[model samples]
Target: MKEITRIIAFYETLKRKADVACALAMVVYVEGSSYRRTGARMLVSEDGFWEGGISGGCLEGDALKKARMAILKSKPELVRYDTTKGDDNQIGVGLGCNGVIDVLFIPVDFENENNPIEILKKSFENNNKPLVVITNSLKEPELLGKLFYFESKQSIDFLKNHLDVGLFSEEILALEKSKNYNIDNELRLFVEILPKPITVYLFGNQYDIYPLIELLKMLYWEVRIVSEPNKIQNRENLTIIAPSDFSENLLNKNSAALLMSHSLEIDKKNLRKLTTSTVKYIGMLGPKTRSERILNELAAEGTKIDSNKIFAPTGLDLGASTPEEIALSIVAELKAVFSGRNGGFLRERELPINERNQEIFKFN
Candidate 1:
């Protein structure tokens, strides 16, 4: 997400430098498993600065080299990384993530807002709806770099300099549910749905909440601190509000919240609000006994807390004693809940780690 922002933010800078060439790299398709899913992007300027990433680390350097070539030739190219064979370069590189990733490199005209990179960033700017990028070139390559948003009624053009397009409304409408679509034998489309940034609502403005806020920021997510309005500091992408101003309407249904005042009245008040709201996750920071007491109190008040949406004795059991470690644990637990995982050790789970659905695709 930060990478997308970086690309949009640097558009003007790239545009101003007439001689400075830049290339846009996108993970058009992924087979089996990958660290970053399809639609992941990275921007490489002529100055050797890459704003995003396509692979974990194995294929970035190689992609960067290709991006430079794309800039010089003023032509787009396709790059594929298949590490499943267990002998292809990863044999010595030591980092062989078994997966097949298809990346598309396009020379970007940052000056044009209609360019694929700009179009993508603009599509996600104000809309909560998922935007899909259709391509027919990721399979064996040739005519693929075309992009279109379903709602815009745009046509799919695979062999054009710019994607100025229209597909039937019904065709675009159906893609909302499907991830991959095959238009024809030669025109296979890999649909990439754009997602809005995840918002984390941290209830309680304790000193410890600062760490969690900082960490979430690193993940490039939106953070709304529901604490004393006066404690609100000047921060970017952060909303500070007093507990009195808390409202479920202010948040989306997918938002995750953590309750950490450790005060009975405060926790109870927040819990009551959470129990009636549509927000999906509510974490209460305390011991299991403490959680039971709070649940009983709420039960007596006739607002029975839904066990499914609540996380008591909040945070994973990582022997987190320090405030920082506790903050890490709580955030880890929230990340797990957001991804619908148990938040356990990866090694204990399975061998092909990429198979885990770390990031979930939300379909409006």
Candidate 2:
């Protein structure tokens, strides 16, 4: 969600500048170690301003140059960066993690109906799910810059006249099984399937809670503020009454919730209300003692809470003291939880940070 938002924001900015053409750089394939993986995108304006990043600073300068050429030629181009040489570097990180990256830069016009970013922005803004976007970088002056988008959940009747019906059918079937991003060079397609962001329910209305709200919004996660009807401002994504208030309405089954009302009584009540819920994650803001006390009260009440899903003294041990830093820690936890990580140091992990797609293809 944040990725799509970044593209939209940069495109809007470029549209405001007079005679400022734009190009989007996206990582199509990664050979070894790269900071960002396939589907990572960066938007570069002819004026040198850019948003997002395809790689650590190592690749942006080179990408900016390619973007300028792309804008001038008004043609999409695939640029390769081979940092496998020990001497080759991009802002120091690439030297440590040498990799080969294929970046495709496509000129963009915001007003154009077929613009890829515009299409993507609409999909995200509308909260459309399972949007599969395919680009054939190898076919310049043809499908190189063009994109094929489909709502994978629906029957693709429009695909009858599609330029690559067989290709679409094969990949769509594959997608139904794995439902992940794929860089199929043999098919000449850089396929990216955008999934829905995880939903979160924040059960608080305190001033400090505002910081958390800000962070979540930046991540483009759908957050529902569950509280008293009069406690919260009528925001677009906020829910005034708690889900427990109405049995028919429940929090997203695959969601995380935070309990931080600043009042012990209210927090305890919330814990009790959500005790039996299938909502996997229940985060309580405060010291371990406070959370334990709440649990003790709930236990005495004969409520059976899923102890494994409860996160007391929520957030990583980041030594966070300020409200903003605390908010960062909390959101970090949520991200780690969503990815099934322990929120620990990345260096400790043996696997790549960007989970590699098991399905592999090589470009000839």
Candidate 3:
């Protein structure tokens, strides 16, 4: 998964910054079905530190215990988890959902030159991209890792060195675009580079935006506060703008705009501009009736607005009363839209439990 690649990148940065040695576990294959796919990685440290995951739940505890053992033993290992019912209840894992998973525990001492993981990780960091790591070609039809960069001539050589086979750049490019590669009898990994953080534009200096802005910063979102000259405070990632000072062309595709202006003229002007722009989400803080009145006034003045693109009441029905709670509710709605989730209750609905949860894939 790409998240795995990001975690590895963070590790690479950590090791360089703090001089800490780390280890990794790789999930190579699955029999039947598994919660996590092959190529899922878990990083563990000698000091009982850990980050990331291998299987959904079946492999974490064992992987951590074994990884700590690997740190003590100074050896790598290949481990398997069987979900089949066993004689002793404690002997093996019971997934409740059935499946068998095979994971390769590759321990890397960041200080060791012979470590394949360290080399592979370095390749990714140097290139500012993702590297594919192939595990098994026989008895497993899989590949793992994120596509860090587009397929390049250097990647062919990189693959040849790591996988022992000369894969062409054309196929690798195709695999990078697809985000997944099906290599015959091989465990394939394609790692993608991380994108920039999403930008949120808050178009008001109201007190409601304070907690919301704080919440956005807490989630590491890039926030720009578009407000009157004196209204803007000294805050990181914040910009104050007068009515005439706003720029329409510089908005990024992942940018979202919220119009919480207490002034009608300011709200109307921004609404007209944002309605015609490429912002993914344009939320206005008000009741549905107020929103309709604004739209009707705009329509009378010969401007068209897409109803689906605007969120009038601007949050999920979470019964929020406080500014912080309301901010949470709005963020929940934004997250659901960003992640392509339905934003519905699991217990009240008949959706499959797995579907309700954030699962990667479902074979059945």
Candidate 4:
């Protein structure tokens, strides 16, 4: 979700600089194992330019057609694509794509009043701000509505309804303390209190770290560059340290570590302390042979490395070479892991290609 926001901001900025029109599409609901779900976005420009995606190739063709219509009419509409029918040649917007998806296409011009992504982007820029998505559930599927309620640390205001002010406030409170809350009922009017950005610990000052930081920054990640002691600090948000300087107290309150230091000894030393910590991710960047060696060495020293907890050879094997390319591959792998997507190709795996169904979304 955070990455999507950043990408929207980037596109919005580009649109402003280039004076281009862009339409934003979001998948508000999915009935079955569809390619994308609520919050999946695709931004299409006037000249057939696009960034982001709403679904796999299955529904994009239909979306492209609607995007052109939205641009021509300058009025957006809620669209649906149903693939429940087994027929592959079914036409029309609601024809199932072997699954059903409800999408809302909103034409957003930087100068328009209906530019929600841009407004949402502005709200997200301030870490302490909170916003509510007032979706209308009275309709079939869901409608994201033209109104959005937002409250920064300073003010609380509504774009549409003022009667449900109390309900909106309670939702804001829920989002403020959003440790774990079931948000099914709050689909349309889902309130997201923008909390602090997630912290990412990049454990290395190698040549690769530069591009990694750049990519992560573009994704709105709160990155901390951890380098060896006496290492000249270059980045603004960096922490220099010796091998022993690593401490639990130093880890961010909700940080995930990326082990790209390329030093097996330093990596193992930190892993010893981190294995028992509460870090969300500890991705080791290396080949399978080196990763196995580190695991064996940790085991030899009595460190019980949980197989499920570690992501070795961190990032997908996209045959990355240059630093920029490597960073993209690593970010893609991290996103897959975070989103519970198998990094392996769908055709290569025996599991169903679409597992975002109700059966799989269930998590303990």
**What's the residue-level lDDT of 247 in candidate 3?**
79
Candidate 4 lDDT over 61-161, as tens digits, reads 77877887877777656776777765556533354445667677777766654476666666666554654443344433334445343553223343223
Candidate 3 per-residue lDDT, tens place, 1-364, comes to: 2454566676777568655555677665565556775556778876666777876665677788878776676665566677755645532455564666666666566676636455555554564344544433344323222223434676556445334333445444444221333444244443333333577888998788989888887776777888776776655556666667777765756788888887777788889988767777888887788877888899999998878768888889999999899899888887777656768886775654332112222111
Clashing pairs in 4: 82-95, 82-96, 82-97, 83-96, 83-97, 83-98, 135-188, 135-189
lDDT at 249, model 3:
65
Per-residue error (Å), model 1, residue 168: 7.8
Clashing pairs in 2: 58-90
lDDT of 3 at 143: 27
Instruction: Give lDDT per model, in order.
Output: 0.70, 0.72, 0.64, 0.65
RMSD of 1: 4.9
Model 3 bad stretches (over 4 Å): 1-20, 26-42, 52-58, 68-92, 95-131, 138-148, 151-154, 157-180, 190-196, 237-245, 348-364
Candidate of highest TM-score: 1
Ranking by TM-score: 1, 2, 3, 4
- The candidate, 1 or 3, that scores higher on TM-score is 1
Best by lDDT: 2
Worst 10 residues of 4 by lDDT: 355-364
Candidate 1 lDDT score at position 205: 66
